[model samples]
Target: MSPWTMPLVSAAVLLLTGAVLVALWLWVNRQSWTDQEKRTLAQLEVVKVASGIALGGGGLFTLYLAARRQRTQEEAQADINADAEARRITELYTKAVQQLGDDKAPVRLGGLYALERLGQQQPDQRQTIVNVLCAYLRMPYTPPPERAARSAKGVHRPLLRNSGRRAGIRRPEGQSPAAGLVDAQQERDVRLTAQRILVAHLKRGGESWGELDINLDGAVLIDFRVSDGLFRAATFRGATFIGDMYFLGIFTGFVSFAGASFVDEANFGGTFRGVTRFSEVFFGGEVAFSGVSFAGYVTSFAGASFAADAIFGETEFVGRTHFRDSAFSGRAGFASAWVGESAIEPGSSWPAGWTVSGEATSRPGRDGHDGQWFRLVRTSSAAPPRPPTARS
Candidate 1:
């Protein structure tokens, strides 16, 4: 009931009780009786009032006890239901993980889907499921030789002939090494499926897994792409990216690609809000960072190598930036790039021929577009650095 209405209701009940009491007193006074009878009638009236009060109080107490009991029962039921749900989730998770260990590729794919579905249903378990997938990718794996390489010069070469035996791939007495290659191919497909599952949920919009940290250290990613993703933190240290890589997203926390290798073209256009690293990275194909914003404590590309064109046009560096010991075999460009005045750290190095302009221009601040900004320009016609030696 409303607070205002409750007071009115109580007042009405009080008035009704007063009126009934006054009527009973008047009736008793109007009756002509002796003093003894009058005293007896008064005693009877008192007893009746006391009995009514006792009954009414008892009824209210009973209602209070019943309501409390009902509340307790409901809470108990809710607890039981919650416990059952938790058990069900645990069972499903265990089953899916077991399936992942199956020898058949189809079974492994099914397990990936099962885990994906579980994550969608149970938001709290999403990170755990993602960790499992990353672990699977991190497992030692050697991709099957490309079809072109195997068929080159009309020779049937089995790339995993010796390793397959060591890996315990059972074969018939006269089975050929090609059987092991087929198994490798199957494993590759399973790994690719896991990668797809991760990319599907990491991207922005439709069923996106919000701001999860990803750790794929030393993992091999084939044709990885993170278009429009939001990461809290990520690590890809010593990872290998086969085929093209696309990283168009936002990193709100620390991100590292140190000691990584990109075998194909890499296109990076995103906003890095925390410390970013690319130390000792190798880019076998063209790499571009056009229009990218690095707003972090430090952005390093130290000891990195670019075998093909390295483009950094219109890039913004809002914090300490480093390109020390970096090598570029092909053409390198930094046209119209902006760096904050406080971003240049002592001993920080740029490309051999490139230098920051003497005049500091006004652009937006870190939050806005106007602030003190310096442009990078080519001051000399020096040759680009020689490519680094090939890895062992």
Candidate 2:
């Protein structure tokens, strides 16, 4: 109510009371009541009316202040609770990461699981946990040398040998496997487990994490698979694939494989939905993309080299695919490959030893007239010519 409302109402009530009292006084005066007694009664009534108005207004204002104060206290308590909860989550995350640094493989595995659980429980921590896991995978580790010679192995064996020597010296016995040193087999298992965890979370649906950016630069991976998965961004720059690698993932963001080496066979049967780069990549063994699709705006393979047969049979290039200055050391097959109004320039960068299949070529004969040599033509043609039929 307005400040003047209460005062006005009180004054009206007082006037009515005074009028009634005066009428009573008139009647009483006609009787035996004295004028001084009526005056005393009127003064007492005025004092009571003033006191009631003051008390009622004061009570309402006090209640309003109390209610506001209670609300403020509740908000403050809630803020404090949120802060404490955040602190607790941070502590848990720290403990789990610390466990990953433990020397024992089992302990490290436990730490991975803990981080995984934490990420699942806290959606905000998912990307951080993923980074931690990738960092672990990116760390250097030596697999035991399969051969007697230490340098012949593909895995990191120097770290293992040093660890063993340190353990041997510390042992009370003459020489023994070092304490807290993971053996080659155990180390391999750990690496495989890490790979599995990464792949499992990247799959679609069923607790799978989406829109993750993976950076595995200079990491050593073996028999890796990214089939039927989705990623925000993926980079394997300078990475070494020890065994066969299958890259069939769908990239929604930037992707790179510059300077990456595929030691064994690699199959890039994937779909690119964004910018993609594969410059200076080396495929040591055979590589095939029989049904792959490159649909990104920019797909580059500048300076990439293929040692063995590189097949692109039936591959679809729906976007700009560049292979500028790339070397094909072996047969480069593009039989039945489709370039649907897209840009794909396979220039004359092949090595002298390289030969392209399904190309129509011609060389001069002893005769003055021009003579046809090979049945395929090599040019920067976006649309592939009709593939020659196979001989019976």
Candidate 3:
């Protein structure tokens, strides 16, 4: 209560007490005191006592309610502040990535590092965002906190390789190359872009046969998603596939052909490596190759249905290979090529009498021990014992 209210209450109490005293004084001063007046004085005293108890109890209850309401409001405000902070952190992290460069490298790295903190506090949303960001950074692996910490962290570096930098150095739309020279500026831009993203993604981790199709000349590392999407036509000319390259899960709107290849060596064994699928894809342009070689567990067309000719000339498959159940509509020639392997099983049946002619092809070593698998069951005497060379 206010200071004024306290004084007023004191005055009311004093008036009540004085009135009671006056009544008592009058009784004592009276020549005769009635029983009815005595009863009225007793009732007045009981009412005053009850009023004092009720007023004190009501004041205490009101004070408790006010305190509880204040505490609840404070807690609600705290929760709101916490939510705002989380959203701000997430936004800051996204900005750091979008505007990343050498000048902003500090912010970029800080943003990635901050995820470790935010993820600790707000585990759910932070983790989801972290997973996506890590993917963009193209880090090979991203583990959860405890395990990630337990194992040594992989310092993530990014590089771009064989981006459409090959978009140049080719004959112009209506003009042929001036003799045997390339536009030097175009070549430099292409080389620089490749060196940046390539040195990180490829040179560091060393993966294979993968097509990273973003626009050329951006100088953006592999640290971002292909928001504009895959490349139109890629070139790996004079580029070595030291590691098994992969292009299976790619969704390129145009063609991807790796010509002029050094596909397989000791450290470089080409396999399906991972799942390779080119499902229902159309290649308007030809997939030309001059000297592409494959070694190791190689699977070129796995569940792939090609509408164009998989024209392989001077190409070599030196290991367990399969073009199993794949459709090659146009001509498929293994001309002047060699296959030196323990076994070569052909799965594609020629229903259209589709030609798979190898004009000057030679198998390095031929074994007759494979007779159990392909020995003749029906004799065609008219065809002259179906010569063992033909093997009916």
Best by TM-score: 1
List runs of model 2 lying over 4 Å from the truth: 1-67, 146-182, 342-392
lDDT of 2 by residue, 144-260 (tens): 544422332333434445666767654256432332133555666777777888888887787888879889988878778877787888888888887777877677888899988
lDDT of 3 by residue, 166-228 (tens): 544454585333311222222223333333333233221232213433322112122122211
Greater TM-score among 1 and 3 belongs to 1
Global lDDT scores for all candidate models: 0.83, 0.69, 0.37
Count of clashing residue pairs in every prediction: 6, 7, 11
What is the C-alpha lDDT profile of model 1 across 1-392, one tens digit per residue?
25675466545555655566666667676777778777677757955764565556556556766897899899999999999999999999999999999998999999999999999999999999999999999988878679833543253535666776668755558644566677777888899899999999998899998889889999989989989988889999999999898999889999999999998899998799999999999999999998889988899998898888998988988888888788888888887788887676574578778878778888665435457888898888776556654341
- The parts of candidate 3 lying over 4 Å away from their true place are 1-45, 87-91, 98-107, 131-392
Residue 241 of candidate 3: its Cα lDDT? 26
Model 2 clash count equals 7
Task: Look at candidate 3 and tell me the lDDT of residue 125.
Answer: 49
Error of 3 at 108 (Å): 4.0
